[model samples]
Structure formats: structure tokens, C-alpha cells
Target: MKVVLINPPHTAIGSRIPDDHLPPLGLLCIGGPLIDAGFAVALIDADLSDMPLNRIVEEAANREPDVVMLGHSGSSSAHATVVALCGALKQRLSDLIIVYGGVHPTYHWDEILRDSPCIDIIVRGEGEQTVVDLMRTLKAQGDLHAVRGIAFRDPQDSAKVVETPAAYMIRNLDEHRIGWELIDHSSYSYWGGKRAVVLQFSRGCPYLCNYCGQRGYWTQWRHRDPVKLAREIGRLHREHGVELINFADELPTGSRRMWRTFLEALIAENVPVLLVGSTRAGDIVRDADILHLYRQAGVIRFLLGIEAYSEATLTQIRKGASVHEDRQAIQLMRQHGIISMATYVVGFEEERDVDLWRSLRHLLRYDPDQIQLLYLTPHRWTPFYKTAEHRQVIQTDTRRWDYKHQVLATRHMPPWRLFLWFKSIELILQLRPKALYRLLGHPDAVFRQSMRWYSEMGRRTWLREVFEFMFKTVRVREGQSLKTFLGPTLEAREYALEKAKPANSARRIIPLTESR
Candidate 1:
């Protein structure tokens, strides 16, 4: 059997602004197992070159593969694109098998199967093991009902959707290696054009942040063998000439002891690769003693999920961290010579102008080396979705549902005012004298370059967003409610978590004909 994995191009500013690209880690992960299982596998990273939909269809059709798997890291935002691309591919090749998977499809499988006939199957949760099993079953022309962790159109009645039992979580992450040979290393780069790749030391988050879908989608927190991961990092550095590793993990430092051991092992390997990733602020505070190990192990920066400055908001979202700890974590990282990026999410609460002002003031006081302002994007699978279900949606287009865009309407402020506040806050934060000084005059040359590169990209993105907002972007005045737009919530259908339930338990499938 032949398989071609497609990483659909994304419209997010981050994807468009960067001069370099990172390999699609998700596709490559499943590709590894398929290759080891003796199936021919190839990767067409359309996002790498931002290929057009027609070109993507042409390329995939030319390959004439038995199965075409499609996914994106920014699944919700890229979903429409995936649908269009798959539709086009099916037009070109009528008998092609199209499989879709990601955070969005994992939760919204019912809606997808009902609406998108171009998609043959939706692989829920983790796909490393599921893809292998699925492909083998397809090769044997066996019943798809026998495959776990998947949803497909019923053979007898194409209108009906059948979701098989959830696949057991792969207890050991090292069981399948990434298919590094799938891509040329020289083409990808990050942190000022240094050859880079996205790697994950762990999966899922232990914290129960109400607004996050990661905890539910990933099922539970798990990590690769610390020493083995370190060794793999070393090998990538030595053989592939990878200079920077952008961790795709939600929280790499969830386990302090395991994280420490990984750091020590990486240091022992003497690899000089730069490491950058996101982690909770509390984790940084917890690892205060081993901060030196992080710096020595090539961790140049850590983006802390500050989420909000107000204690009330933090408690409301169940962020599991206090404002004090957030402040302290930034200081600790700075003291250890590691750059700290505080990610402050907007719209977590219904913010008035005064609230925005207060949030900006708090951010200035925290004094992180960098800041990322994102909007609160509620996924149906997350707890926060239910809370915000009654709110009016401003952006009806699913493509703009990425955290970069404002989705829900604000009762206290108009869309224009909210956008102005966002731009103003971002401008003030980035143009602050302290941030400017670091971008131009940081003592470490590497850090200086990184800051400068980020500033340039941010500036471009800022201008592009302004242009789009003024001329291109559209928002409805009186849109449908969140629940009405997204349909019913699917929080209970968490596939990975369902693995622990009894076999005789009720199936989690919800048919399209059921009342919303």
C-alpha cells in the first residue's frame, strides 16, 4: 500500500510571515510507523511552500497513492482549507481514500463525516498506532468496524456514521520514531534561519485549564524516555545539522524530575542545538534550583502561559497558577539568563476599556523579555466552550477561528474598539524601551538576533492584520450564538480518556440525525 501525507497550507500570520518552515511533526510521526510496517509513505508539505489548492491536488493526484492523510497543527483554522483541498483531490481522483485527523476533526468527527463526503475516515485522538492499524485493514480489504479510534460512513448506509472503539493510548512514546527521512533537513529553518524542526518531549497537560482542548485531546500527560529523547536530539543535531528545536509539546516540564534528567542528558551529549518551547509559569518556578541546567542544555527561551494578570480571571479559567508565581517565574528565567516570553491571552473575561488598561499595566509590571497577545478561542471539546456557548459569535468564518482572530463578540466593547485596543496594547508592549533595548543591544548575540527576527516578523504581521481588518476581513453585526453556530458540544467523546472505561460502556457516537 502507498500513502501520501499532506500538511495543508495555513493562512495564519505565523505561517505566512516566517521565511523558514518546520516539518509537519504530526504527519511524520504516523509516517514512521507506516514505513516500518512495510507500506510506502511520502510527505507533501504544501505549507512548506504555501502551495495553492490546485497545485496540491495536482501533486497528490500525480502520486496516485492508495491513501492521502491530511492534517494541520492549527486544525480548527485549517479545517476549511482541508475540506476544499480534499474535495479537489477527490475530483481529480475519484477512488482516492481521504483520511482527516487533528484536534478539530477529533472532536467534530460527526459533523465532518456528515458534511464532508470527500473525507473517508476521521482518525480520532493519537494517530501513530491508529494509522498503522487502519492502513493494514484497508490493505486486507477488511471491515473498518474492526479498526479502533476512527469514524467512517456506514458501508450499508453512507448517510450514517460509525465510530469504532477508542484505541488504547501508546503507553511508551518511543515505540514509534519520527520519519526524519521523509523531508530534507536543509529546507527548514527557524530562529534567524538556523536549521530547525519541531519535536515533542511530551504530550498533553496535567493542568485542567478550562479553555484548553489539549488536555482532553491528548487524553493524559505522557513523555518519552528522558535519556532516549536526549539521545535523539543529539543525533538530529549531529546528522541532520539541526540547530534549533521548537518543541510542539504543550508542557515539556510537567514532570520536574524527568525534565531535569532530559536536560542533564542533553548537556552530556554536548549538542549545541538551541531549544525553545512553551511551559506553564508554575513549572518554571518549581525548577528554580535547576535553572542553570536548562541554560546549559541549550534552552534559550521558554514561553510561559501567563493567560491573564487578574487573579479572578486565572481562577475563573482554572489556570492553576497565581499572578505572583507568574511574575516570579519571569524573574527566575531572567536571573538564569534564559529569555521569558509571557503569553497573555485576551478576551478570557469580558473586558472593558478599563480592564484592557489594567491588563496592560500588569504586563508592563511583570517585565518579561517578550510578550504574545492571543485571543481566547473556545473549542467545543473544552470546558470553556460551554461557558461561552451563549455568547454571540462575531466571526462566522471557521478559517479565522485561530487564536489570532477574535471569534466571540464582546458585550462591553465593539469590534473596532476591541481591535484598536489589541493593536495599541501590542504596539506599546513591543515598542517599550526595555523591549527595544533587548532587540537591539542584548549582550548575547544569539538572543539579540532571535529578538530582532521576532520583532521583524511581528511588525510584518501587525501591518498585515491592520490591512486585512480595514479592507478584507468581515464580521457580522448580529451573528448566531456560539452553541447555535458550532452545534452541540462533544466534550464527552474524548477518545483517549475513554480507553480507561469499561468495554461494555455505552458507545460515545452521536449520529447527525439526532437533535442538537
Candidate 2:
């Protein structure tokens, strides 16, 4: 069997810019197993390539693969683009089978099957073993329903979706290898000119942040061999010109001892690739003494998820840290010359006009080298969704589900005013003399170039958002918006989260594993 997997060129604001592109590591993961299964496979990162749909069609036609698969790790926002790409592919090759797999399709497989005839199958949850089984079943003309971890329409009844039970997550990370040869390294980059590739030290996060989907999707936490990971990364640096490695892990620092060992191994190699990742702020505070291990191992940046400044908001989201810890983490990173990116999320029911200013004041006091602001996006599968379901969606289009869009109703302000408030907070942080020095006058040219590129992207995005808020008319998906272009009301006001019971509080006494 022959297969071609496409990381569809996304329509998100980030995708529109060439310098902002990152390689599709998810597609590469799926490609690994398919190659191991002895099926001929080709991977196309159309986003990095920036190819038009027609040109993608031409390239796939040349390969004449028996199957074409498309998916995005960031699924909710990329659904429309995938659907459109499927339609174009079906039109071009009448006999081809199309498959998609990701978070959104994992939950809404039935809707996708009923709505789009072009998509033949969806592999749910993790894709490694599922893709291999799916291709084998297709080649042998076996029953589609017999394949685990997939959803497809019954041939006899097009309206009926045949969904196999939940796929077993792969507990052993080493078995799933990346098909690095399938990717052209020159096409991807990070931190400006550093040739980069996305790699993973672990899967899943242990913390129970209510709004997060990673904890649910991964079900448990696991890591790869520390020495093996370091050796391969060293090889990629020495042999393949990979100067930077972006970790796609949610919690790479879960096991502190293992993390330290991994760092030591990489430092021993003395290959100075810029390593960057997102991790909980508490992790940094825990490993303060070993901060030198991080710096020695080439960890140039850590994006601490400091979702909010107040203890009230932190408790509400079940974020397992306090404002003090967040500030300390930032200080530690700065002391070690590691850039700390403090990310704050806006748009909770209880937040009011004063809350924004309070947050701004807190951010200035905490003062990290970098800061990012995002609207809280409620995914249906998350506990946060129950509280958000009744709220009106301002940007009803699935494409806008990216964290950039404000999805919930505000208590005290309209959408435009809220956006203005958000922008104002951004300006207060990034426009400061200290922040400007960190961004524009950093000692490392590569890091400086990256910060400037992102600054350019943000400036354009902010202006575009202002234009949309003032001029563009959006049609809400369901409930009526508070205004012609904003969100609907959350019936329950002044609500806050109770302290969480414990880890796995809602589950049976089963160990956190693949079968959860």
C-alpha cells in the first residue's frame, strides 16, 4: 500500500506568515509507524512548503498513493481547511481514500462522517498503531468496523457511522519513531535562523487544569529514554544541521531526576542547540538549584503557563501554582539568562474592568523577559466546557477557534472594548523600555531575530483584529451575541472553583494509564 500524509496549509494568522511556520511533528509521528509497517509513505508539510492546494494536488497525483491522510494537532481551528483540502483531493483523484485524525475529529467523528463524504476515515486519539492497522485493513478489504481507533461510514448505509472503541494509547514511547528522512530540514526553522525540528521528551501532563485538553487526551504521563533522546538530538545537531529543538511536550519536566539526567547527558555532548519548551511554573521553582543544568544543556527559554496573577483565578482553573511561585520562576529564569515567557489567559466569567488593571499591575511587578496574552478557549471535552456551553461565541467560524479569538461572553464590557483592553495590556508590557531591550537588543542574534519576527507578526495581527472588530460583521453560530459582533451571557455570574479533591478525583481507583 502507498500513503501520503499532508499537514494542511493552515488559514490561521500565524500560518499566513512564512517566518512563523513550524514543522508538523504530529504527521511525522504517524509517518514513522506507517514506514515501520512496510507501507510506502510520503509526508508533505504543506504549511511549511506554503504550497497552493492545486500544487499539492499535482504533487500527490505524481505519487499516485492509494491513500491520502490529513490532520492537525491543533484540530479545532484547522477543521475547515482540512475539509476543503479533502474536497479538492476527492475531486482530483476519484479512487483515493482520505483519512483525518486529531482532537476535534476524535470527539466529533460522527458529525464529520455525516457532513463530509470526501473523508473516508478518522483515526481517533493517538495515531501510531491505528494508522498501521487502518492501512492494512484497507489493503486487505477487511471490515472497516473491525479496525480499532477509527470512525467510518458503513458502505451499505452512508448515514450510519461505524466507530471502533477507543484506541489504546502506546505506553512505550520508544516504539514510535520519527521518520526524519521524510522531512526536508531546510524548510523548517526556529529562533530566527536556527535550523530547528520539533521533538518530544514526554507525552501527557499530570496536573488537572480544568480548561486543558492534554491531560484528558494523553490520559497519563510517560517519557522516552533520557540518554537515547540526548544522543539522537546530538546526532541531529552534528549530522543534520539542527541547531534548535522545540519540545512539543506539555510537561517535559515531570520527573525531576530524569529531566536532570537528560539535561546532563545533552550538556556532556556540548552541542549548543537552543532548546525551548512550555512547562508549569512550579517545576522551575522546584528545580531552582539545578538551574545551571538547564542552561548548560542549551535550554534557552521556558514558557511558564502563568494563566493569571490572582490566587482566586489560579484556584478557579485548578492551576497548581500560586502568584508567588510564578514570580519566583520568572526571577530564576532571568537570573540564569533563560528567557521566561509568562503567558496569561483572559476571559473568565468573574473578570471585570478592575481585574484587567489588576492583572496589568501584577504583570509589571512580575516582569518576565517576554509575555503572551490569550483568550480562554473552552473545549467541549473539558470541564471548562460545561460552564461555557451557554455562552455566545463571537467568532462562530470554526477557523477562529484558535486561542486568539475571544469565545465567551463578558460580564462588564463589549467585545471591542475587551479587545482594546487586551491590546492595552499587551502594549503596557511589550512597549516598556526593559521589555524592548530584551526583544530588540538581546545579545544572541538568533533569539533577537525570532523576537523581532514575532513582534512584527503581533503588530500586524493587532491591527487586523482592530479592523475586524470595528468593521467586519460576524454571524454567531448559535445563541445571540451581546452585540452584533461579540459573545452571549454566561447565566451564572460570580462563580469560582472550589478547591480540587485530589488527582484523579473524578475517576475510579485505576492507575493513570493508556486505557483510562
Candidate 1: what lDDT?
0.89
For residue 41, model 2's alpha carbon misses the true position, in angstroms, by 1.1
Which portions of model 1 show Cα errors greater than 4 Å? 495-511
User: Can you write out model 1's per-residue Cα lDDT over 1-516, one digit (the tens) per residue?
Assistant: 889999999998789987978899999999999999999998999999999999998888788899999999999999999999999999998999999998889888888988888999999889999999999999999988888889898887776788788777777999998999999999999988999999999998888898887888888889999999999999999998999999999999999999999999999999889999999888998899999999999998999888887888899999899999999999998888788888888887888999999989999999998888998898888878888889999998888888888899999999889889888988998999999998998898878887888888889889999998899889999999999998767667643445464646333445666544
Query: What is the overall TM-score of model 2 with all chains considered together?
Result: 0.89
Residue pairs with backbone atoms closer than 3 Å in model 1 (clashes)? none
Q: In order, what lDDT does every prediction score? A: 0.89, 0.79
Best by TM-score: 1
Candidate 2 residue-wise lDDT, 218-319, digit = tens: 767889999999999999999889999999999999999999999999988889788999998889999999998898898888899888877987898888
TM-scores for every predicted model: 0.98, 0.89
Clashes per model (N, Cα, C within 3 A): 0, 0
Residue-level error in angstroms, candidate 2, position 10: 1.2
